[model samples]
Target: MPDNREARAAARTDMIMRTTLALAQETGYAKLSIEAVAARAGVGKHTIYRRWPSKGLLFLDSLLSLNEPALDYPDTGDVMADLRRQIYAAVDLLTGPQWGPLYQALVGEAQHDPAVAAGLGERFIRPQTDKTVARLRAAQEQGQVAPGFDLDLAMSILSGPLYFRFLISQEPLTRDYVDRVLDALFAGMGPRGPADAPASA
Candidate 1:
């Protein structure tokens, strides 16, 4: 496979995406334009349009390319440890300031753009969230979690506090904060043993 042409095209695409992310980081999405992206990317106007028909499509693709690979569920012979690792991996990505603004803009845009909303749900949310639920289910099968624990509800509990910290309180997202949330969640949902017996008379 000595196709020089394909390799060059791929490199150009990568350059465009890198340049687009840099611009989007410097300026809000509302100010993004094809011309600006072309200038930043060092590509011709026709080159940009040849691939993406609209700014929304280009922006969506650019944002998606920035995501890290989904964290695979680890089987460390201990459910609690595995879950803590998985949840924290997600939290780390969300708290990174470079990508946080992009996520915020995407969420805000999803409120009005059905196309972007659907794309987000399919491409990013489903893949990552499904892994989380699967990990929880594996733990449940091993009796490490309560049999009646609602998987969806449980994930929400694990993530809800972190989201509130970042999106509501606007506080610094720190490991200590994540640890506290995980502790409270585990207290509520982790395994339960037999209740203590009544005291002797």
Candidate 2:
């Protein structure tokens, strides 16, 4: 357990992150200010600065903290099944009430603000991409993915439709759609062979 001072500091930091996400969702990140977060979080501005150099970092930290817990992938040995499960769980959370507003606000603001864009990519997008790539490579070692497949393209195939639906199409994201995405991706990347033959390396 944390000592009194450490416990208080942790509590204060959580408050700041919670407040930043809420205010940013309501006011939008482009309009959110450190002063407002401090005011809402009930902490001095200096307390925020002590950890994050600016409001963008503070906002990014809040997003990273929120995403970290949900990002863990439980490998069930069947790579495709695991990927589908993880993607659906993520889509559910991103589309759900608790975090969707902040997600949309951050993404909307990132388009107009380069710092926010970089922070979002660095903190959120890149980690997810890298993690997926690592899993794809592992799947290849197990002969689940063709050796010729590009890991980057694999990441895109997994995420492209999900984001397109989330940010553009605004269609309902279903588990069936998630399964289809992976199935199509695998078919394209799978080995070339006769219809009844096994895939070759």
After best superposition, candidate 2 residue 91: deviation in angstroms? 0.7
lDDT of 2 by residue, 1-201 (tens): 779999999899999998998887787777899999999888899999999887777877897786573665667777887787778888888888767667877787688768889988987888878878887788888878877789898898789898898888889888888889988998877655567477699
Model 1: runs farther than 4 Å from truth?
2-4, 196-201
Q: TM-score, each model?
A: 0.83, 0.80
What Cα-based lDDT does every candidate model obtain?
Answer: 0.79, 0.82
Which residue pairs show backbone clashes in model 1? Answer: none
